[model samples]
Target chain A: MRRPPRALVLLAALAASFFAVPLAALAWRAPWASLPEVLTTEVVGSALRISLVSSLAASALSAFLGLPLAWVLARVPFPGRSVLRALVTLPLVLPPVVGGVALLLALGRLGLVGRALESFFGVTLFGTLPGVIVAETFVAMPFLVLTVEGALKGLDPRYEDAAATLGASRGLVFWKITLPLAAPSVAAGAVLAWARALGEFGATITFAGNLPGETQTMPIAVYTALLRDVDAAIVLSLVLVAVSLLVLVTLRERWAPQA
Target chain B: MAPARRSLGRDAAALLGLAVALSACGGEGGGGGGQSEASRVTVFAASSLTQAFEAMAEELEEDSPGTSIRFNFGSSSDLATQLEQGARADVYASADEANMIRVMDADLVEGEPSVFVKNKLEIIVSAGNPEGIRSLEDLENSELVLSLCNEECPAGKYAAEALDKAGVNVEPDSLETEVKAVVTRLQVGEADAGIVYASDVASAEGEVEGVPIPAADNVIATYPIAQLTDAESAAGEFVDFALSKRGRAILEEHGFLVP
Candidate 1:
């Protein structure tokens, strides 16, 4: 391979350092001696539990709902397909706070659907665990859908056609062939969605509200802790950073080894 | 191709001329002989002061042309933490003494902060009192969803104090990070009720109504304003203006008690 230009290399190094500096500063300011005590505190513990539960639930929800959407987008030749794809990808670009406001408008007690839900079933999702999962899913599902859709589009159709010629049903061809072919992308997308959900702050805080052990996920906990306890906030932030780093490293090694 | 490139070059030159003209206009305003040089003062204040401070900024700017005020509004504790972390601002106005003391302890203030206004806690509900919430005890209704500020927020602390004083053991469905968020929860009807400063209800522009907490059970929040140690000359003037009679009248009109 041809060597990169020196100016390009220099620019890449500068960009790398720009990202490294803040992480270094956080590490430098971390209270390493009190990490164990801080991590084990009730606030941190509950936040961790909530973050884990909500993020996992969001990832599962994304996979269950997104797979069909991704398949439909990839295989269907329907009018307005591009518009539908754009709408699905909208949350990826929209500010999470704005997403939260939209969620409240659609799901709050007085909202269009929310009012009906409240009146008929006495169910309100605001400030509940389900609300956090909903907010997370709203922001995170696009990643899974987009990733899986790309994978589905890139797959060779001959394998499924060959299976169909062998008298296998469409469902059997999909389950026994197409799904297995796209398994790696599915795994990668699920992990990406989980990481995005774990780091979600704005939408959850705005839509679900920040209640400890219920809606106060790790990001919200870190923010609340930052106000009163710098050390605790640093510890919580470091945990999130470490988890994100792990996700990236694992994805590179398992799914994109060439990179 | 050559003509396209030539037209692009002309477009670039036109853009450069426009930029130069804009900067020239800006320079003339600052360099005019008889007028004071344009100055910008950044004030970091609590979210509860959003409307009243914006009004004060408009009045102050009108009174002294070429003087502009920028605000960074959030929870008091968040503002204090930013000051401690060396975020530069000319003035700091906290909703409670505790956060102001935190900044003072960090040596961020030029001198002692003076109490400029006081606020009392009130139960905020959606317009027309949809739930017919009338008092603090009404907040205890199991069917009602309550949102309050987290313990780190001054309004949250005040709400907790008031609740304690009233011997009301109602559990909040959500603990928001800022007082404004609690008010927002009520405004959006995500929450049946919330406890926030009286000024918040007044500033909410009738989207929400206040159910007055009896004086005996209300917690008074003392708001203090101070110029930062690194502030410009205009910062002191702004602080003085906030303590002036006109400022007091504005605060009173917004349902705050002037000191």
Candidate 2:
């Protein structure tokens, strides 16, 4: 029944508008009428497909790789555990472009490990579909790792211990008891990682290189369109906005815990 | 709980409206500052002009002590899009005529753009030309990885033209956003060869070797400079200076052809 403080309201209002106006402008200037034409084009179609596939794949890989790391960090206290945790979260703060460059230097044809891989197996990672996935996973895995790690740390160990006491092996206890209880957190982390990967730009462009129907995900396509067709770029941006909003809304209702 | 939830929703809606209003108030503050600052000139140039233009900016500053020149360099299409979006730049020197046409189509330019310099496509290979990429046709060897700028960039268009003229149908490993990225791909050995501006090869400083395209197959990419319609008087002066004999000499030193 009481009004909120006027100063707090004023500050909140300013911050909200600052965050919302750019999206509003994008909405206002978007070529809504020709959106279907723009979105149905070969370029948009391929980019959308690539974005979806790469982000989803990145999410799966993140869950696969990050869960074990999270488990180790949360349950096993090693000498350099904190340092290892810090290194794992580096992608969260590193500029995506620098991350891409690092990936290239470590995995490119002439890269340290890449040189051996190329000469031995005649396999190349650069400029391939797998390269895009690798770049996205590199930037996105940290989200899953931190989230699942937090969940693992918070989870009661008594349930796993009880299962172990009943003769369940460590692996069995983890798969049956620990994983089920951590399912919600894992799902949340995967969604967050997928969303992050979907919007990846700098690393993908730098490491994977932009190839249409291959490495040119939605962000790269939008960037290329900005260089060619502004209206088309706006249309692509609107598509991205729509995708992100959908993700947010779905997550809030089905996954995100209320404050 | 129901009452609290209802009130929270109402508060969010009210805050959203307030934010939109505040944003409207903020938007009006930027357009008024351009006219009062007459001694400053902001030039938006193509990415390939970065070194030459930086040198030119220093020279211009020395020539006119009180006037300050700022340069914004990126892909020509990107710069043109910024101009269309009403970026407050005094002059735009695009890497190609098509991008200049985009700006002119928006009625953003005050006068006709003059061709100040020209650039040609070169097949840039690794230091020793390990892949033996000697000509445009060699780029189509399928075994040799290749990179090029995205089709939206002037360098990409020029590269495509050169390839088409030579009847080469090489599938690029990656299409970069600008000439510099293509050059970088070659220098890192991520690509066996890349098509970039001759100036980019010159700037690579032995990191890569330039395989010259035959004159008959090469595309002469022209740089166009013009003042914006709403730019300050100093913009025109800067444009003139960039087109002067000294400017041509500087561009030549960077491996650009005199127009």
Candidate 3:
């Protein structure tokens, strides 16, 4: 192996520092002496519980719904497939606040379908735990769909075809052969979805509304804390950063070992 | 391997150039001669003052050619935090005395802030008052979805006071970060009722209706304005204009009670 150019290495180091400096600053300003007390506060505890429950629920919902969508997108060859893919992945790139507005329009009490749901079933998702899950799933599911689709498309087709040739049913081949082969990717996708959902702020606040012990997740807690208590906000931020770091390290080691 | 490495380095260099070019494009309107900088008076004001401030800015710019007035509108607490964190601005206006005091305590204000307007809280509901929400007591109905500004915001503080005075105990479904968000929630029909400044209801232009809060139960919010310590020479001029007769008229038109 040859050494990289000195100029390229210098630029790369500068780029890395750009991301590192802010995290370092956050750590520097953290209230280390009071961390335990701050962490034990009811606000922090409630926000943590809400964040954990909603993010995990969002990930489960994403996997349940995304797997089938991914399989279809990867295997089916149909007209407007590209358009369908674009529509499905729109949430991945669209601003989360805009996604929240769209959600309110579709599912809000006075919304097109929201009105029907409210009148027929007396169900209103706005400002509820279910609303937070819905908003998170809307933004997180696209990650799972895209990731699983890529993995599904990358799989060798010979095994499935061979299984089918041996007089196995489609369901049997899918259950015994396809799923096991894609299990690792599915797990990776679910983790990515969970991480994205954990950090969700805009959509949840916009759609689900912020109420402590209910819709107020960690990110929202940090924001609210920043307005009145900078120290508390810093502590909450550190918690989020620690969680995100753990997720990244786990992903690198267990899911993308080759990288 | 050497050839591939060289091509990769070249591509990286190209990417770096594109990034620099894009940043240059993004900076277009913000960059210019020192003359523009001197003429640019950036005023950070509370979100409830958005409509009135914009109108004042238009008139001020029209009266003084070559002068540009830029405004940053958000929750008063958030703006105060930003000013304390050294965000550059010519003038600061807060929705309540508490936030103004916070900035003064931080020594960010050039002089004492003067109260320029007084606003009272009102119950905001969808157009036609579908839920027939007539008073603060109506907000307590469990069937109605209520939204209020988070307690960290001035509007929220005022709303809480008013609700307390009215002896109403309502658990809001969501606590928004800004007064405008509360209005948006009401406008979008996601919330059945919310408490916001009377000016906000007037600014909504019939999208929502305001149910007057009896003066006995309403809490008044006083808006204060001051030039910042680091303000440019023109900063004082903008502050003066906001407190002028014409400025007061614009605010009054928007339902504010000019002091």
lDDT for every model?
A: 0.80, 0.79, 0.80
In DockQ, how does model 3 score against the reference complex?
A: 0.02
lDDT of 3 by residue, A82-166 (tens): 9989988999999998887788778877677877988899887764567888999999999999999999999999999999999
Error of 1 at A110 (Å): 2.3
Report how far off residue A221 is in candidate 1 (Å): 1.2
| lDDT tens digits by residue: candidate 1, B1-259 | 2333344335434534643454344333322223357887878888677678879998999998878786655567756754664445799999889899999998988988999999998899889988998888888898999999898887888899999999999989999977777876775578999999888888775678988999999999899999999787799878998999999889899889887
Off by over 4 Å in 1: A1-8, A247-259, B1-259
- What TM-score does the predicted chain A of each candidate obtain versus native chain A? 0.90, 0.91, 0.92
> Worst 10-residue stretch by lDDT in candidate 3 chain A?
A250-259
TM-score of chain A of 3: 0.92
Looking at model 3, residue B74 earns an lDDT score of 54
Instruction: Please give the lDDT score at residue B245 for candidate 2.
Output: 96
